[model samples]
Target: MIQFMLVDDESIIVDSLHRLLEGQEDLPLKVWKAYSADEALDLINIIEKTEGQGIDILMSDVMMPGMNGLDLSALIKSRFPELKTLFLSGYSDYTYLQTALHQEAFDYLLKPVDDETVIEAVRKLCLIIEEERRLKEQEKQNGMRLKQAQRMLNDELLRELLEKPLTPQQLADKEESYVQASLSVDQCFILLNGKVDQWPLTYTEIEKMRQREMIMELMVSMLQPQCSIVPYNGSRHLVWLLQVKRMDHDSETCDLPQLHWYLSEELERVQFTIQERMGLSCSFVISGHEVDWLQIGDVNRKMGELLDRAIGLKSEIMQVEQAGEAMSRYQDIQLQPQEIKKQLLALTGLLEAGEFLAFMNELRSFFETIRKSVFLTYERQSEIFITLAGLYLSYMNSRQMTTEVGMKLDLTYLTNFNKHTDWQSFGDYCVRLAEILFLIVGDDAKEQKQEIAEKVDNYIIQNLSRNLTLQQLADHVHLSKFYLSRLYHSQRGYPIYQKIKEQKLNRAKELLLQDDIKIKDVAAELGFENVPYFTTFFRNSLGMSPKEYKQSYQS
Candidate 1:
């Protein structure tokens, strides 16, 4: 609604202008009358505070007692530049006309104004006010869209930096464009790879995605105070660039051990929070040492390789070791590729049939057969490990599982062949892998239904204020709308829509008990657009309007 204020010392002139504006049915104007400029200013302030926007138009006599309309318009324009102004004067003085023009008044009317002239002036000014408001709103929306686009571009750049090789100058240019704005190249940075472990095996794909996002946010919140972090979410892993400056006076020396200790403490807190709040566990691997600005990509790859190897280890925080030790551990292994292929085919068949015990027994027998043979060299053993890893990866790929599952394997033993002290140790690793595979494919039809139902319930509780639809809820958990409706009905003994309404009403009842909240605001907060509809809904559900419910609670 547009607001208007008319100021004149003469009661007759103010009354006449107010009546004319108030009578216009075509103009949706809330008219305010002021006898003097001071009163007008007071009323305008009140309107601004209450409505959160100033009056749309000000129509006042140019020759007022204390402040003339021209001076008043100037003052108002300085504060509320959007407010339109029109001046009224009895004299046809050129000086008055010049002052009105200088003040940028919307229109100047000689006093004893006709009804048609007054209405026409207001009508034209109203159109201008609306146009300006529309343009401002458009500009604000465009700015928001631009920011979202920029964030998407930055995420893409981060991904490209990890996956593709770029020249040093190209990397520097990209960093200058995106990274330098928030972080400095002079500071040392560590790239960390993170994975959420034992996320509920029952969660749907969408639920898992949401949980990963939640964990990422939790980690950022925990680490933000110490350094600037840039996180990228991938199919199976989360990557972060933690940038920090050395506080030591010497530029050449940095207390990396102390920094790692501090980061470990922070990660422990993150682990606890994720477990306590979401019933999930996370594993993080940090790059062993700080790197120069241009070496982030290399550090990221190195950390990723370390994380992959550390998957089966009990430790949650794995750091890259010194380059010499890491290089010395690598041994050239040679094996008959055809023989390994034949064995992997048999292993795949066992895993496919969900024969967990038989899969372990067969793996032990194969390792025993290999150990007794003269061909079980270090290179041959590593080849066997790589082949087995590939077979498992292929199996998961066939079932549309992600590569992150590889993290559950004891790859650390693969890198350090000596750690596989005997055939039994390798057999133990195979047993663990079989167990995870069994869990992934073990659930029956009824169990799957129950899992979907629980996911739906969790989504509803998390978004009670959102006026959720069945299709929206189904899409969130990757279920068909029809199937989800039937499942939810069978599990809860009620329709899904009814459950949504019940939850909203129950939440509304709780909120209405608070004295400070307004009934309309509560309705809006609960996703109701019309206050009357909300009132009716409340009365129908609880036998009382929200206001009455609040009053009763107070009583």
Candidate 2:
């Protein structure tokens, strides 16, 4: 039975209400009676401490001696926030009290209340409490089921099955979760890996979350009824285990070569659709043969190896068989694919960080990536070496020194990836270029030029009253007048002299604004030859003399 409390200043009223409520077995309430608010509060403290619960309903008179119904209700609610309160007030008191209090509900019975009205109000509150209990129980059960579903449906389970040799029980778990029903029939799964070339740089975390879901939905639309699992573990990559929906499987099962082409073509549509709809340059590498459930780990590793090389590469699509040269070369030795991938991927970062020693150490494995690349054309390879040489030479001249790097080592490999015909000699020359980047300490010559241009503008502004010449500006940033002029023009797209003239003109007009300052004084303050020279300069810029411009402003 739910607990109830009744409070009134009169002893007879409290006693009558308590007996009246307790008699209704259907509404079943254990009623507590109190003649005053203080007595009601004292009884509540005992019930809370002893029964480990609070009163479910509290009904009290609005106007009493020490504490009225409104004040008592607020005090009890602070302890038990969900406690339901009903006020006992006359018609005049109820009208005024209703506006003063706004709790979860403003419910009450008027003074001289009938017995049926008291029973009905308490009955309604009990039903509401019971319904809330039912919903809370339902939500708890649903939450447990959702957690179990998330564990079963996540990509971790898919990865574990593909990457490790599972125990029989583990195998049974995978089967029960996704494969048990299909065990009676023949099935083919193609492993396809996709990498988003660049996530939208401008997207906020919330927008990117929505974009990922939309892209996955697009992929599922094309592959469903054929796809068993696609678990994207919130990486830059998406891995799908696509079960081929083949009708004529009897002959197609043996034709692994033809099957490879067919499966890859189907997966390519997913790539094309995402590229078109989402505007993300995604690269993919499909498994070249039908994947056996037991042999999944082997295929996954090979695909991962090829993907590692293709990841930083532009919109590249390939299969295992396409990289025949690298595969054949590796057969003669343990290729250490992971090491080669790290060496290749590290070049851009190593160069940026100016890590000369690290570059030299990894040069051997670095060359291995270029030599083993199936997609890099001879022209592209030549361009790669040329670009590296240019970066080093550019750094050398950034510090005003142009020195030839190689005498003994052949530099022709700097023209082409295979030109020197000797890896050690080529690497030796490249090491010298790496040395240039390390020693300079300043990366990106463009950024260095921008800094020089900014300093020129600041110097001209700060020393405007002095000799604000091009030579002085160049001297400020430690560059020659000729080179500084060229550098500033490259960054700002205007001549340095034009910039100085504009600054002097703007300053002349500003200084001329003061009523106490004369034209001659303004000219001297702006580093002009005389008032005549400053007047000529101002008239040429604004088609008005400085005196006339100041008068126009004053008007």
Q: What is candidate 2's TM-score against the reference?
A: 0.37
**3-32, model 1: which lDDT tens digit per residue?**
898998877668767887999989878899
Q: How many clashes does each candidate structure show, in the order listed?
A: 2, 0
Per-residue CA lDDT of model 2 for 1-555, tens digit only, reads 678889988665686678778888888577888888899899999998987889888898888999887788888888888788888764323234444346544365544455666777788677656644554686596684564366456556666766776665666556765543333124555677766654553333444455565566566666554434454533435566666544464533334445457656676677677777657666777775677776667777667656544423445666766766544544544335465445555765665565544565566456555544533333444455665666555644665545433332234545555333223334545754554343334345556567777888888788777745554675576544444555676677877767777888888878878888888898888776567657776887899999999999889
lDDT agreement with native, every candidate: 0.67, 0.62
Query: Against the true structure, whose lDDT is highest?
Result: 1
